[model samples]
Target: MDSLRADAYLQHIGVPRPGTAGAAELRALHLGHQLVVPFENLSIHLGQDVPLREEALVEKIVDAGRGGFCYELNGAFGGLLAALGYEVTLMAARVFGEGGRLGPPYDHLALRVAAADGSGPWLADVGFGRHSHFPLLFDSRGEQSDPAGVFRLVETPEGDLDVLRDDAPQYRLERRPRQLADFEATCWWQRTSPKSHFRQSLVCSRLTEDGRVTLSGRTLVVTGSDGRQERELPEHEVLDAYRDHFSIVLDREPQVAPLDA
Candidate 1:
């Protein structure tokens, strides 16, 4: 993508031009992305195709005003960062699932961004909802504090780094860089396999100034920043919440696929 397209991306995420490819700009972009683009699996449930191509991903997220899971969100964000002159790499990770089991190789896509000064490569992920709100210093082995929670990257016995959120293992990060296409098979499985949560559930969520709002199936949940006073929206208002919070205008209710027997 060209610089003009990159500027449009900046506008999509509601971030102003930072004038340079520096750590500050990277952080701003990460924050803007997290605040604007949400983490959702609605398309999978809508029976919509989840394409991995950078241009299509950008069109979906930026032009269509939509949100998507890791592959779509991180894939597009990495392209924007690369277009804007940052050194960006697509990295694969294995999501930590039930019973601490690693899901699979390429279970997730994340970004490694480097400053123009060659000072650092930070873990800048806007797709991992509930992750650190800003870029986490990649070189730091110590516990890093952020608005999301206390996070740490610990080297595993097998040599990969385990990202811990509040001391819980989130995902094991592989050091090698990857192309967006490398995740195609797993992305397919995730959207169609019975064992994959995305195939059985429907969710749309976005971060708000006071808290976060989510529509899981037909349940509308609102949690405050302090994580208290969680409440469910009335059945009559659930659809409206989807439109109001997520900017998604659905012609009909999104079907939640049931777990396969």
Candidate 2:
């Protein structure tokens, strides 16, 4: 990677420059940006191939002013951290949704970044559709509070990890580091299958310094340091919420046909 251009990627994902910023600040920047940017598949539904190249991904995200599913978001952000002089590794993860089944291969891509001291690399995932805004400390058997909510990482019988939030389990992650191409087929299946949740809901979210906000289907949930609230809204409100919170334009909007769901 061209080091100068790579430095630009650091700014693209909002990882702060070490010349002034610290770890906590960098973590906050990344977490908040991911939430604000969203993790949507509108482009895919509209016939855009989520590209793998770092330049293309950055162009789409920062220039076009859009958000994307795991690959585009995390993959591009991974490039950013690497350029920022962080020891960043691309890790693969599997989703554990309501039914409690492990999602297929390449369901998610997260980052493992080591601190300057190398105490242990942290699990920082900004791509998960719904997740904590700050980096989840990798060395935890305990829960921690972030701008999003309370979260914890628990090891499975297989030694992999599962992310739990609000006492509800989310995705299970493998220990293996992954490549971007590993996720292409999985993304295709998700967008095309009736079984995928992304095919069922119109979601847009963002994490902020105080809390996180999300519009899921017809429901809008806003959580802050004080408390959180969830309420149902009309379709127009949902669309407006997407544009307002995440800056995503759902031109076809999932509400009309309900996303093949």
Q: Quote each prediction's TM-score.
A: 0.94, 0.81
| Model 2 TM-score (2 dp) | 0.81
Tens digits of per-residue lDDT, candidate 2, 1-261, equal 466665655566565556533466557657646745777766644666766777888778777778877888888877766766677788888887567887887888888877564445688887886687678788787988975689988998999888889878888888887777777788777776777776655566666667778776678889887899999987567667767877766665655244533
- Give the lDDT of residue 186 in candidate 2: 84
lDDT of 1: 0.85
Query: Which candidate number would show the highest lDDT if scored against the true structure?
Result: 1
Candidate-wise lDDT, in order: 0.85, 0.73
Off by over 4 Å in 2: 1-16, 20-22, 217-241, 249-261
